[model samples]
Target: MSEDGARDDGRQQRQELGSFLRRQRERLDRTAYGLPPAGRGRAVGLRREEVSYLSGVSVTWYTWLEQGRDINPSRQVLDAVATTLRLTDAEHDYVLSLVGLAPRPATRADAVDIAPAQVQRFLDALDEHPAYALAPDWGIAGWNKAYERLYPGVATTAGENRNLLWLVFTDPSVRSLLDDWDDTSRRFLAEFRAEAGPRLSDPRYRDLISRLRAASVDFDTRWNEHGVGGFVSRERVFRHPELGRLVFEHHQLRPSDHLDLQLVVYVADAETRRRFARTKD
Candidate 1:
C-alpha cells in the first residue's frame, strides 16, 4: 500500500480500537456502578445521553461516536469518559494502547534509545528553521542547531526530563516565549494530562508531575481541572526576541512502526519567513 493508504489504515484502526475499548468500559461501569444493564434500552452500553453528560459531548455526537458511525472525537472527549469510568491505571493505559501509545512496561528499562541518525540529519537539514524530535511522552529526544537558537534554554538542562510541556509550564523563560500565557498553558496542560493518564503509575511520570506541581501554580490548577487535548494541527504565535511576534503552523508527524518518535516541524508565515531568512544571512 502507498504511504498515504497506510496512514489512513492506521487512523481507521485507531478509531475502531478507541470505540471498542470505550464500549467495553461503559458496559463494565454499568455493572460495577449499579447502573441498569444494557437491556431494552435504545442503545447498548451506557445510554448515549449519560456518556454525553459525563464526557461533555453532545448526545447526538456521542451516539454517533459509540455506534462507530461517521464521527471524529477529540482526545478531550475520550479522556472525559476515561475519567468518568474511573478506569484503573492499567485500564487507562489500555485506552491509550488502542491509539498505538503503548505504555512502558514496569520492568522496562528507563533508558530510551536515541533517535536514528537519519532523523538527526533531517532536523539538521532544516538549517533556517526550528525542528525537533520528541519521545512518546513528549521528552526532547533531539533538536537541530537552529531550534536551539530559536528556542533558547530548551535543551540546556541535562537528562531525559527535558519535556516541552514541563519547560512550558514550569520554566519561566520558556513560558515567556508565548504571548497568551494563560490560554497556552491551559491547553498544554490538558494535552499533557490526556497523554499522562496511561503513565500515571510510572515513578518517572509521578516524579515529573510532582516537580511541575511544586514549581508552577498555573500548572497545578490546570492539572487539577482534569482537562485533555490532542495534538491537532494548529497555528501558534510566538514572541521571539529578535523577530518579535511571529506566527507558524505546527505539524506533527508520527512514525508508523516506532510510534514513540514524533517529528514536529514549525513553518513560519511569509513575514516570519522573511525575518528568519534575513537573520540567517
Candidate 2:
C-alpha cells in the first residue's frame, strides 16, 4: 500500500473509533435518562436530528460525525455535543481522546489542592508584584495582598468567579485593563477550552461556560470554534488605577503532582517595577 493510502487508513480507523465512542455515549445517555430501549428500534438512543438540535449542529453534519467522516469539530462543538448527550466527565475525556486532543488527567481534582499554609506563604513571598494561584479552570484559588492592591477589582469580582477566562471574556473591567482586548480574549478563551475539556462535568465549569455564553458574543463565537493551545506566555498591559499602564509577563505553572492547580505569576518590567515602587509613596 502507498504511504498516502496508509495515512487514509489511519484516518479511517480514528473516525471509526470516534463513531463507536459516540454510539456508546449515546447508549449511556439513553439509559441514564430512562429513554426507551432498542426494541426492534431503527436507531438506538437519540436520533441524529435530536442530537443535532441539542448540540446546535446541522443534522447532516451530525450524521457525518456518526459515520466517522473525518470531521474536525471545534472544542466548542464537541462541548455542545457532550452537554447535549449529558456525558460524564470520563465520557467527555474519552471523546477528546478519540479526536487526539489532550485528555484531562484522571488525577486533576486531587492535583488542584493547595494546602492553606503553602498558599499563605506563597502570597507572603510576593512582596511587590501581583501574583495569584488559580485552579485548573482558572478560578482564583488564592492571591497576595499586593494583587488585591494592584487589582482592586480582584477582591470584589474574585468572589463573583475567580476564573480569569470568564473575566477576560465577560467582564468590562478586564477589557478596560487590557490594551488589546480582542486578541487577549481569544487567547484566553482558547486556553480555557483546552483546559476545560477534562472538567466538563464539573458544575463550576458548566456555570462559568453558561455565564460567558450569555454575556459575550465574541466569547461564544471563539468557544464554539474549538481552538486548542496551552498557556505558554501572555503579555498583558494593565491600566492600573494607581500605576497607570503597567505591562506584566504572565506565566502559568503546574506545580501540583497531578498538574491541576496553575500558579500564575505577574512580573513587571523595569519601568513598571519603578512605577510600582513610586505608587507606594
Candidate 3:
C-alpha cells in the first residue's frame, strides 16, 4: 500500500475506534459506578473525566482518544480503559486493532508454505503418534497416518478450509474430539492471532479471517475479542471413535532450518499406548 493510502487507513481506523469507545462509554449507567444521577440536561453515561479518573489516564489523553487524534495508545492504557468501561473480550480486541497493538509472531517468516519431502518423511516416521506440520500461516502442510486416523477430516478438508483455526472452529468432528472444546477453541484463536500479528493486513490473512467470520459465529466472536497468547505444551485429551479416551502431551517444534514451519506432535501416555497396542493386536 502507498504511504498516502496507509495514512488514510490509519485515520479511518482511529475515527472508528474513537466512535466505538464513545458509544460504549455513553451506554454505561453513571449510578452503576456510584456516581450521581444525570443532572438536568447532562447525558446519562459517565463523563470523560470520570472515565479518565477511573482508568488512570489523563483527562487530556482520554479526550484525545475519544476525539480520534493522531496520538498513540499503549496496551496497558487500553486494558485499563477496557476495564473501566467493562468492555467484552471482542470489544477490547477491536480497540487494540485500531491502535495496532495486537501480538506479533515470535518466529521468522522465511519458510515455504509447502513442507519439504524430508519433513514429510519425518512425520511419516511417527507411526504411533499423531503429528502434523504447520506452515507460517497455520495451514496444515503435512500430516502422518496417526493424525489422519485421529481426525479423518484433515485429509478431506478442501483448500483454504484446511487451516488449523478454521478446523478448530468449523469442523464438528474436531469440536467433538476435544474434551474441552470451549477453552481449546478460544486458546487456539488467541495463539493464531499472536502468530498472525505481522500479517494482519496481508490479503491472504484477511481472506482467511473473513472466510472464518462468515463461516462460523464462534470464530467471528472470538476474533472480535482479539485474545492473544503464546503456545505452550500441555496435556491433550481426545475421545477417539476407535480408541475411546486417549491422553497425550501436545508439543510444538520449529526446525532451525525451517523456522516458519511448526511441527505439532501428540505423544501418547501409557494407557493410550496400551490401547493402541490392543488395537494392533
- Runs in model 1 with CA error above 4 Å? 1-110
lDDT of 1 by residue, 1-281 (tens): 99999878867766775576566655654655566757665233676676678768787776665555644555666677677767666666766665556543443214343667888888889776678887756678888876776786866776654887788876776767887778878876787677667678777678778888898788788888898998777888888877798888888876664455888888778887787777763
C-alpha lDDT of all candidate models, in order? 0.71, 0.72, 0.86
**What is candidate 2's lDDT per residue for 1-281, written digit by digit as tens?**
99999778868766875676467555654555555655565344766777788689998877777777767777777778888877777778777777767754543333342435676577668767778877766777778766776767777874656567777776787788778888777777777778778778777777778898898898788888888877778677877666688888888666544245677788888898887776553
lDDT of 3 by residue, 111-228 (tens): 3556889899999898778899998778899998888878889988896678898899888889999999999998888998888897777767778889899999998888899899
Measured on C-alpha atoms, candidate 1 has an lDDT of 0.71
TM-score winner between 2 and 3, please give it.
3
> lDDT of model 3 at residue 265?
95
Ordering by TM-score: 3, 1, 2
Top candidate by TM-score: 3
Model 1 TM: 0.59
Clashes in each model (backbone N, CA, C under 3 Å)?
0, 1, 3
Residue pairs in collision within model 3: 89-225, 90-224, 90-225
